[model samples]
Target: MIETLTRIPVAHYSNLKARAGYSIKIDKTEIALFKVTNGEVYALENRSPHPKGGVLSEGLVSGNYVYCPVYDWKISLVDGTVQAPDEGKVQTYQVEIKENIIFIVL
Candidate 1:
């Protein structure tokens, strides 16, 4: 079966500051949105991949990686991969900006 992707409008581009993390919920899924300094917006599962599970939205954003607040695991926002020395990965969603509105593809 083919899966259909939906574009869910979350927020405006101007509302998100550069190099900051914003949290949004779609149905039961919690997503963390990050607007990088380069004007790129990335979407990732709000939950950390660590066994303890930290909140990615509360994590610090440095470049394209987010440091898990609980375990300090550096997770790549681009592909949702946990950095080396850490194991596991989070779910990443595609993001698009149209007319200053941010939409997350799910």
Candidate 2:
């Protein structure tokens, strides 16, 4: 079956910087947008799997992973997978940047 996606504009490219991320709410879900060190952007669920808190947007971003601020769980920004040595995962959203505008596929 084919999946239908809704692309929603979240922010402008200039508002996001390298190695940092921003959090926004979509209905009841908290979405985090990150501009990785490689100049590419990624989107993930803002909640950390360690039960620490929903602070993935404020976590320490190093390369492709963001270390949870409360419990130090390393989460991969590329796919929202909790790094090995840890057990859970968050949701990864498909992202598109067109003409410097960021859009998240839902």
Candidate 3:
């Protein structure tokens, strides 16, 4: 059965990394949070869509996309859509920022 997701506050700009990863709790779920841009945080499934690898929180950001470190696959930072060659899309979470604090809706 599909379960409902919960939104949880993750961090602030002082604690967030530029295109890095951090974990947060959302309805008892251990979520992987990514701070992709300033004032624009992108949330995605911790697991990568291409093969079985990490979701690439540390993946290189070129333009508006990130490249998965595993197979060098580029995933869209804005929507988590699989870019080009890659197939399937990873889950994406709604992100909102307030007072420099990052909030994510899993």
Candidate 4:
């Protein structure tokens, strides 16, 4: 089966800085956008799976992982999987880049 996705333009590439994350709201859902040090962009649900806080956008990003600020749970930005020694996961969104504009699929 083929999956169809709605693409929503979020931001420009220049607006996102390396090692920084931006919080974007799509309808009623909150999404976290990250531009890793290597210029890779990722989109994930803005909530941490640890149930402590919804500050994944402000979490510390290391490589492809973001460490939750409340409990220090490391989450993979690529797949939204909780790192080893922890369990739980966040939702990841597909990202598209066109003409330096960033879009997230819902």
lDDT of 4 by residue, 5-94 (tens): 899999998899887779999999999999999999999999999857658999998999998878899999989999889999999999
Best by TM-score: 1
Write the residue-wise lDDT of candidate 1 on 1-106 in tens digits. Answer: 9999999899999999987889999999999999988999999999998877899998899999999989999999899999989889999999999999999987
Give the alpha carbon lDDT tens digit for every residue of 1-106 in model 3: 9989765677785687666766566665555666656535677776677656765665666655677777888777678788776777777778877777777865
For model 3, the superposed segments whose C-alpha errors exceed 4 Å read 1-6, 25-30
- The model with the greater lDDT, 1 or 2, is 1
The candidate with the higher lDDT, 2 or 3, is 2
Q: How badly does each model clash, as a count of residue pairs?
A: 0, 0, 0, 0
Each model's C-alpha lDDT? 0.93, 0.89, 0.70, 0.91
lDDT of 2 by residue, 1-106 (tens): 9989999999998889888879988888899889987789999988898856658999989999998988899999987788889889999999999998999999
> Lowest summed-lDDT stretch of 10 residues in model 2?
46-55
Task: Return whichever of 2 and 4 wins on lDDT.
Answer: 4
Question: Candidate 3: minimum summed lDDT over ten consecutive residues — where?
Answer: 30-39
The reply for model 4, stretches above 4 Å from the true place, is 1-3
